[model samples]
Target chain A: MTREILAVALLAGFGLATGSVAAGPAEDLKVYQAYFEQHFPDFTPEDYTRGMYNFSQDKRAQYEAIMEFPPYEMAVEEGQELFATPFANGNSYSNCFENAGIGIAQTYPRFDAERGKVMTLGMAINDCRVQNGEEPLDVVKGPLVYIEAYMSEAARGKAIDITVPDDPRALAAYEEGKRIYFTRRGPRAFACYHCHWEAAGARIRGNELSPARGQAANFPAYRSKWGEMGSIQRRFKGCMEEFGAKPLKPGGEDMANLEYFHRRLSNGIPLNAPNNRF
Target chain B: MPYPMISKNVALAAVFTVMHVVTLPLMAQEGKGASAAATGNGPEAAVEQGKAKAIELCQGCHQFKGADQAGTVGPPLLAMKARFPDPAKLRALIYDAQKASKPYTMMPPFGRNGLVSEQDIEHIIAFLYTL
Candidate 1:
């Protein structure tokens, strides 16, 4: 056989093999974890849950000092009260969630077969309120965030365990989420992949960029810049705005799907929400 | 991967060649009266102005050769004159990298976004040539 023809045959065979096989969630998880482990040998999967603190010792020290008296304590306390308080119909948030809504934050952003959509913890909170004849709280901030903060506190130390079902709908949502993450958009023209994936551990101006791994672990976090608690969706909105794009609606389909994919990246990282940040 | 990438690079180079030809006359015109930094000023003054502009706009994400305290988010600016022999291609990259090169680049569209002017890009390009 001629060298050129043989090379073409080999390439065609390789293409066929790769085209038939798609990477499943397990493969994605393995590769995702491996990438971070290779890039940052010093960090345990658990350390990634702390966000940017994993990149800098100085930042970690400041974070440790801040953690000694976390400002989110009040918000967590209020959330605990809100979670337990009976609705107008005398049924509480407990009735709607498994395990009475305690320590279950890690399993959230789950595919809801009944609802035919991805349901975030914030969405579930609103769903519970709507079901119990109470008005839904603000989806991105305020009381909804407090509840999510409390749930994250309750689920502390539990590893993230997001499951994508065998259903085609669930897989479609996940693929869409993955697309949203890697596709560049807006005037600044950056995908979530640009800053968090490609430039992770690098400095942007004075601020160090956080890794995509374990980013989902600390939500409903207290950012010093915001001077208040914010949910992952709120952070998403802020990031899109920073990209000079119109912010996606919080708890919307796109945001939930993005959260689903993002949370999957932190699959093995333990939940550590209500964390403080600079 | 190598096969397709080689072909893609060749195609990109052809596109850049055309762009360089089309833009050379306009660039020459701008050089005559754009600004003191871009016009008849000596290469030293233009390079100095370009260096200042690079530090102000690009130092946050990219490091220049022989520079300290510059960022590493983007690749270091080294051997620029060799890397981009066609200066118009470099100008196109700084103006709108996505349009000039890869579509998914993290580099912002400094000129298109009004973050930097055409004259500013000229100064920055002059400084980059030195590196």
Candidate 2:
């Protein structure tokens, strides 16, 4: 075959294999270039361009002013203080866990075979509060959630070390979390992979798409676009909206499970909370 | 002494008159050319050349109507007039699209495009001002 025809046949074969059948490589590149040209009219191909991923100077100042202790660090402090401050029965939260070390907070949303259900760290904390004969702190409300943020912050230096307790219960929870991540429920019929995984490193409008693996490390980040301090759950809500999906309530089991999966995927990444993002 | 003084004064006045008469129309024509180009019309046809050039190079992304959705990849051109209200700055942006390096990636340098002439750039600037 002629060189031009051979090139066309090869492109067709590649497209057929990939399932992106509508456009060939040349046309796809054109569309990609056009998309970037239109969206990022000022973008230059330079090494320094990576710096744009960080928060702007003004946003950094705002985050420093507001998120003082980082969310989980403050949560841990509150949890500790609440542990000292007893309920009407004079029982403390320290009696619930085996070691009572805050570092154990990272391994959570594990399956409880005995209970035949998923158990998140937030639930574990609230369960501890209730087991001690005290009214449990609302997982979504009050200083407890912030204290959770604080605890997560305290465990920041520690790597995500979730051990799937070689049990069916834990496996079931992990499977459920994976199901939630891939299931298409939104009006747009887009799964998380549609934007995060399949389109990873692709440009949408003017922004670079972030890899989902590192996503868990930047939770409780200060999103400048929202103009408020928020957690990973809050960012998830925004993503739901973008996908035309109903948002799950904060501190819900599903969100926790989703977080469990996301954190596990980010196994070794260090936490960079109260992070600033566009 | 009075006659000599009067002669010198006349000579000075005549020199000033000649200079003014010679240069005024030339300056006026240049001004008119620039104004006509800005208004999308000019005696030299630069404005017409610019409009054609814009259609060839920019219509792909800017889309003829300047609507944002028309070109989903780029911000709407209609909004640009509002965003860059100043004509001079807009002109500079078009002229140095490669240099501004804003968050958005700019159009390829015109020199690379091989279609844009200096006159074409001037004309495009003129056409843009009308928008």
Pick the TM-score winner.
1
- Tens-place lDDT digits, model 1, residues A99-218: 888789999899999988899999999999999888888877788899999989999999999999999899889877876776566767677877886688998766688999988998
* Highest-DockQ candidate: 1
Candidate 2 falls in which docking quality class? Answer: incorrect
lDDT of 1 by residue, B3-117 (tens): 1122323333354345446555765664533455443355565677678778777887898864556777988899999998867777778888766765556788877876765
List TM-score per model, in order: 0.80, 0.50
Please give the lDDT score for candidate 1. 0.79
Chain A vs native chain A, TM-score per candidate: 0.91, 0.65
**What is the CA-based DockQ of model 1?**
0.33
The residue-level lDDT of candidate 2 at A235 comes to 75
